[model samples]
Target: MSQPHLSSEATDPASAALPLRRVLPAFAVDVALAATLSFSTLMLGLFGWAVWRGIQLAQQHGGAPDAHALQAQIGTPPVLFLIVTTLVSTGGTALLLYVWRRRATAAERRESTRRLGKPSTWGWALAAGGVTFLFSSLMSAGGRALGLDLQPSNLDLIREGFARFPVFLTLFAVVLAPLYEELLFRRVLFGRLWRAGWPVLGLVLSSVVFALVHELPGLNGKPADSTLFLILVYAGMGAIFAWVYRRTGTLWAPIAAHILNNAIALAVLQIYGDAPA
Candidate 1:
C-alpha cells in the first residue's frame, strides 16, 4: 500500500513475486483515502468561509441597498483562511498515509526491505532536476517548431499568491506537494506498472498520466496546438521522476527534484515578472 513490493523474510526472490496483484488493490485503497481526506479538507474550508462571512451575508440578504455591492464587500476568502486550509489538507494526508502504512499487512510492510543501494543521494536529486529542465526545454522547442504559440505556465498566478504568504507556499510547494505526488505517482502507480512487466510501457503510461493531471487544467484558454507540447514536457518530467525513483529505490529522490523544480519556478516568477507582484 505504501511502496515497492518488498518481500517478507525468506524473500519471494522476484521470480515468484506477485507484487503486481497484491499492490493494485492496495493502491486503490490509498487513492480512496487520499481523495476522501482531500474532499473533507475542501468542505472544511468552505464551512470556515461560511462561518466567517455568515453574518455579513445574512445582513446583505436582509435588504441591503445593493446586493452585489454587499457581496463584493466580502471579497475573497482571507489569505489566512487559505493558509489554514492548505495546512489541514496536507497535514491530514500525511497523517493518513502514516496511519495506513503502519496498520498494513505484513506483505505491505515488506516494502521497506526492497532496498537496492542507498535510498537517495544528493547527486541523483540534482541530476534529476537538471534532467527536468533540459527535457522540458527540449519539448517546448519542439512545440515551437510545430507552429504552437505556447504561453507561460499558470504557475505565475499561483506563485503570486504564494509570494504574499511565503511561509505556507514554502511548505506547500517545497515539501508537502512533492512528498504526496511521489507517493501517488511513483510509489503507487509507477511501481505497480513496472511490477506488472511493463518496463518501457510502464514508464510511458505513468509519465503520460502524471503529465495530463498537471497540463490539462492549465490548458483552458490556451492555444490548441500547445496542448500536446505541454503534455510532452510534463510527461518527460514525470518520466525523469520515475527513473529517479527507480534508480534510488526511494521516493526522496523525486521529492527533492520536484521541490527544486517548483522552487525555481516560483523564484523566476518572483524575479522576472508576475502581474500581482
Candidate 2:
C-alpha cells in the first residue's frame, strides 16, 4: 500500500477526486478501536501488576497481598505501571496503523504519496507548526489584554508527570499522542467530512472537539474562567493542523506538524524547567 512519487500531482484534480470514503478509516471503527485499546491497556497494566504482586506476596507469606498493600505498592513504585501502559498504548497504536495500511485500497495508498514525496511536504508541515505557535501566542496575549488569565492549566500536571516519568511523558507527548490524534482529528474527522462535501463543517467541528479534548483537563485544578479562551487557542492550532493536511493532501503532513509543535513545547518545558506551557 504505497504510491509512486508523483510530486507534480499535489494539486492534481484526480488526487482531489480520490475516494476518501474508500481510503479513510471509518469513524466508527476508529472510535471502537480507541475504546478497545484503552480498555486493553488498563486491563493488561493493572492485571499484570496485580498478578505480580500476588506472586510476590505468596512467596513471602504464603498468601496474596492485602488490598491496602496492593494499593500502596501501586503508587510507591510506579515504574512498572508507567512502562506497561506506555508500551501498550504506543505499540497498540502502531499495530493498528499497520493493519489499516495493509488493508488500504490502491487509492488510499495514493492519498499520502501525492505531494509527500517531495521535500515540500516537510516545508508545509514546518510552516504549519510555526503558524500554530504564533497564533497561540497571539491568542494568549489577547486574552491577557482582555483581563482573562489564559494560562494553560495542564502545565503543572505535565511538569509533575514529567518529573515522575520523563521518558513516558516525553514519548507520549512528542510521538504517540500526535500519531493517533492527527489520525482521529485531521484524517477521520476533517478529512472524511471534507471528502463527504462538508469542508466548513468539518473544519469547525473537528477544531472544536480537538480544542475541548486538549483543554478540558485543565478544569480539574484551575479556574474555569479561562477555559473558553484556552479552547479557542487550541482550536486554532487544530485548525492549522487541519489546514496543513488539506493543503498537502496527506495525513502525515498534519502528524509531522503536530509532532513538531509538541516537540517544541517539550523543549521549552525542559529549558524553562518549571515554567508554564
Candidate 3:
C-alpha cells in the first residue's frame, strides 16, 4: 500500500505539476545556505586580514591604530584569503549537504545511494566531461566569430592565484571545487526544483545563477555584448552539469565531470600560460 502510493506520487500527473509551496522552502533554504557560505568565507578573509594588519600596526605604532591608519596599511593577503575561504566554503558545504541528505525521504535516499553505487556513473561522468569541453570550445569559437570576447575571468584569477600557491590551488581547483560547486549548484539549487516537478526551471535558473555568481566579479566596465556572451558560456557549462546530474541520478556524475573539465582547463593554462620560458 505505502509502496504504491510512493510510486504514484513519483509518477502521477498531478505530482508532475508545479508544487511551488512544497518546493519553495527547500529551494529558498538552498539559496540561503549557499549565499551564507559565500558571505561567511568572504567575511572570514577580511577579518583575518584586519587582525593581521591591526597587530602589525600596533607593534609599529606602539598602540591600537585608528581605522584611518589601518585603512592605509590595507593590502590583500591573497594566499591566506584563498586558503581560508577554500577550507571554509568546501568543508561547510560538504557538511550542509550531508545533513540535507540525511533528512531526505527514504525513497530519495535510496535513489541517491543506488546511483552512487553504480560503476557506470563514472563512465557517464567521463563522457559528459568530454562532451561539455567540446561544447564549451564551440561556444567560445562562435562568440569569437561574432567578435565577442569570451575569456573567462575566473580562469584568469585561478591562473594568477595558482602561481602564488601552486599545490593548494591545484587541489582546490581540481578536487575541492568540483565537489563543492556541483553540490551547491546542481544538487541543492537544481535538484530541489527538479524533484518538485520544475525540471526546466531548475536547469535555467540554476545555470543562470551559477554563471552570474562566477562572472559578475569580472563584468564591471565590460561591453554589454561581451558580458552577455561570457555569461552564456558559463551558463551553458552549468546547464551541462545539471543535465548530467539529472540523467545520471547522482551528484558524483557531475562532480567527476566537473573535475575532469577543470583538470583540462588547468592543464591548458599551464601549457600556454606565462610560465618562465
Candidate 4:
C-alpha cells in the first residue's frame, strides 16, 4: 500500500498564505463592525448619564447648570469612547478568530498552554512591576534629554478611575486587558506574521502598528510631543511582549506579564499619585 499524499490545504505554505486580499478585507470588515457597535454603545451610555445629571441639576437648582461644568462633563465622552473601543475591538478580534481562521488546533493550543510553566504568580507580578518602573524611568529620562514632556497623565487617570471603581478597575486591568491584548497582538497578528516567513519584520511591524493605534494627534492638526514619546514607549513595550510570547510559545506568560505590569502601574499611581519630576 502506498502512503497517501497530504492535501494542498494541509500544506504549510498554502495554509499560511491565505491571500492578503481575502484576509485584509475580512479583517477590515470586522474592525469596522466593531467600531460601529462600540461607538453606538458609548454614545448611548454617555447620553443617558448626561440626561440623568441634567435632571438632577434641574431638580436641585431649578435652572440650567454652569456652562463650564457642563462642558467638563461632556468632555468625558471621548475618554469613555476610547475605553469602549478598546473593549469591543479586543472582543471582536477574538470572535473573528474563533469563527473564521481556526488558526491553531485544539492540541496545539493545549500544548501552548502547557508550555507556560507554572511560575509563582506573585513573583511574576513583582518582576513585572520592577520592569514597568525601570522602563518608564528610562523612557522619561530619554524624553527629558530630547526636550520632550512625558508626563504621567494617563497614569493619573487610571489611579482616579481605580479609586472610584476599585473592583471594576481590577477586573479590567488584570483580566480583560491581558486576555484580549494577548489574543489580538500575539496569537492573531504576530502568529500570522510569523507564519508568513518574516518573523523579525512582522514583530517590528505589528509593534509599530500597535503603538500607532493608541496615538491621537493634536487638535490643531499637529502631532503632540507627548504623543510621540508615548508611541515610542508603547512600541518598545510591544516588542518586549512579543519576545516573551515567542520565547515561551505560550500566550499565558505574556498575558500574565502584561497584567502584572498594568496592575503595578495602577498600584504605583494610587500610592504615589504620579511620579515626581
- Work out the TM-score per prediction: 0.69, 0.69, 0.81, 0.68
Could you give candidate 4's per-residue lDDT for residues 177-276 as a string of tens digits?
7677666666666655555554565578667666665554462232387777877787777776666666556656667777777766667666866541
Give the per-residue lDDT of model 3 (tens digit) for 56-165. 87889898778886777866666647565766865566457545542345665567667777788778889988777777778777878898766665555677778888
lDDT of 1 by residue, 109-136 (tens): 4543453334445588788976776666
The candidate maximizing lDDT is 3
Cα displacement (Å) at residue 55, model 4 = 7.4
* Candidate no. 1 TM-score: 0.69
Which ranges in model 1 have alpha carbons more than 4 Å from their true place? 1-13, 16-40, 47-51, 59-75, 78-87, 90-120, 141-154, 195-202, 217-219, 274-277
**Candidate 2 Cα outliers beyond 4 Å, as residue runs:** 1-36, 54-62, 76-80, 83-87, 90-104, 118-120, 140-172, 215-219, 226-229, 274-277
Predicted candidate 4, C-alpha RMSD? 7.7
**Alpha carbon lDDT of residue 61, candidate 1?**
72
Best TM-score goes to which candidate?
3
- Model 4 TM: 0.68
Worst ten in a row by lDDT for model 2: 3-12
Clashing residue pairs, candidate 2?
none
Q: Which residue pairs show backbone clashes in model 4?
A: none
Residue 45 error, candidate 2, Å: 2.4
